[model samples]
Target chain A: DQQVKQNSPSLSVQEGRISILNCDYTNSMFDYFLWYKKYPAEGPTFLISISSIKDKNEDGRFTVFLNKSAKHLSLHIVPSQPGDSAVYFCAADTTMGNQFYFGTGTSLTVIP
Target chain B: EPEVTQTPSHQVTQMGQEVILRCVPISNHLYFYWYRQILGQKVEFLVSFYNNEISEKSEIFDDQFSVERPDGSNFTLKIRSTKLEDSAMYFCASSERPRYASTFRTDTQYFGPGTRLTVL
Candidate 1:
């Protein structure tokens, strides 16, 4: 069962533009959401995360927004750079367990 | 910054042979986890280890699969009989604490570079 879904298979944006990647989850029990950036042949690196209690969390150029009502969360990269080009995976976890459900991932290509 | 590390960046073995993937999680981390991703698929959780015992596991973590913290620094995943379908990238991760704790809010999981297991 695919609890998390990232409908967008790939995304392209010009450098220095805003890049928005979206994700949706079917399980309401997911109280924590995180975004990870991965490069070829490498493991995913934690980018940002947002708690269910908070609507948004920001770290430098990255920001994560969560809409509990819609069971959706988004990762926003401001002034997207070439270094930001990679596969982005959105993950969710419930408080009852530590297992994380990951989305199919969205490949972001920030054109330089 | 200290990071998780996995041995044998790539492993290739016969379908019926046994394979072991090793990992060294962050020293101070209390929780350890194993995850895998089939080519072109989303990452899936296999199991979680805590205090030298398995705290949770996914259905995919069948009887063929097992995890152990054999030593203070080494965590291993062993597949008794590897199947062709078992070929995938296996990742080792660790967290200082669970995402949710009684007093704390959240702690992010650190993942290793991953071991690409190829069962021919």
Candidate 2:
């Protein structure tokens, strides 16, 4: 079963516009969520994360918003740049331990 | 900054043969993990290790699979009699502490340039 899901396979947005990627989870036990970005042939790099205690967290141009009741979370990048084009993955960690479950990933393309 | 590294960026082996994938997690990190992803699929957790012992493992990690931190720096995953279905990209990750965000160096894992194992 897919506990974490990203229904959108691809997204395109104009440069300098806000880009939003969404994720949903079935496991309510998950207490921490994270986002990672990957380029072709390269390992995924750390992006940002949010704890269950908080609804939103921002780092530089990236922001993550969480809605516990909806079991939904999203990552928003303000004034998206061409370099932001990559596959983004959403991951969750249950309260039991540090083990994580990852979504299928969304491919973001910034049209410059 | 220290990052996880995996050897043999790509590996090809005949079905039924044995293969070993190696990883060197960040220095000073105490928690280690292994994950795998088939093309077009989400990354799946395989196992977690701490203090030279396995802390958790998934059903996908079967008897044919074994993990070892033989030395201080190297962590290894061994697959005995590999099957065609075993072909996938394997990644190794590490963390400084047990918490999700706090105590974790990255909160996000530092994935290796994945070891792509192709079983023919």
Candidate 3:
């Protein structure tokens, strides 16, 4: 059973355009959500995250929005850059602490 | 920036052979976790260790799999008998504490460069 799911396997967008990646979770115990970016052959790096209490959080060009009732979350990158092309994984932490559940990940390609 | 580190970026082993992957999580982090990603598959959690004992583990982490914090700085994952399906990239991560974005704390996990294991 997949507790976290990223339905879109791949997405392509023109440079300077908006890039939105979506994720959904079936478990209600998750209280914190995070987005990680990964390059080929490299470990994932923390991007941004939002707490269960917050609806939206932003940093630089990256913003994460969470909808607890919908059990959905999304990462939005405004004016996407070519360097932004990478696989993005959405992960959530259960209240139990430290244990994280990750989605299958969505590959985003920002075309220049 | 203290980042997690893993040794032997890639390991090739025969089926039924034992394979051990090693990691060095960031100093001062108390929570250690292991995750794996099969080619074209999602990253799956294997186990989480805190205070030298497993706090949580997935079903995939069975009797054949074990974790150890052999020393102060080393975390290891050992597969007793490797199976062909065990081939995947193994990642080690560490976190200072639980998720608390509400507090705007930097408790997020840091991942090491994954160790790719190929079981033949």
* CA lDDT scores, all candidates in order: 0.93, 0.90, 0.92
Q: Flag regions of model 2 displaced more than 4 Å.
A: B100-108
Residue B108 in model 1: lDDT: 81
The model with the greater lDDT, 2 or 3, is 3
List model 3 lDDT by residue over A1-112, tens digit each: 8999999999999999999999999999998899999999999899998889899999999999999999999999998999999999999987656677899999999999
Writing each residue's lDDT as its tens digit, candidate 2 over B1-120 gives: 788899889999999999999999888888888999999999899999999989999999999999999999998999999999999999888877677436444445677778999999
Ranking by lDDT: 1, 3, 2
Residue pairs with backbone atoms closer than 3 Å in model 3 (clashes): none
lDDT of 2 by residue, A1-112 (tens): 8999999999999999999999999999998899999888777788998889999999999999999999999999998999999999999987667678999999999999
Report the C-alpha displacement of residue B21, candidate 2, in angstroms: 0.4
True-contact fraction in model 1 equals 0.79
**TM-score of every candidate's chain A:** 0.98, 0.98, 0.98
lDDT for A103 (candidate 1): 99
**Model number with the top DockQ:** 1
Worst 10 residues of 2 chain B by lDDT: B100-109
Candidate 1's residue-wise lDDT over B40-70, tens digit each?
A: 9999999999998999999999999999999
Lowest summed-lDDT stretch of 10 residues in model 3 chain A? A92-101
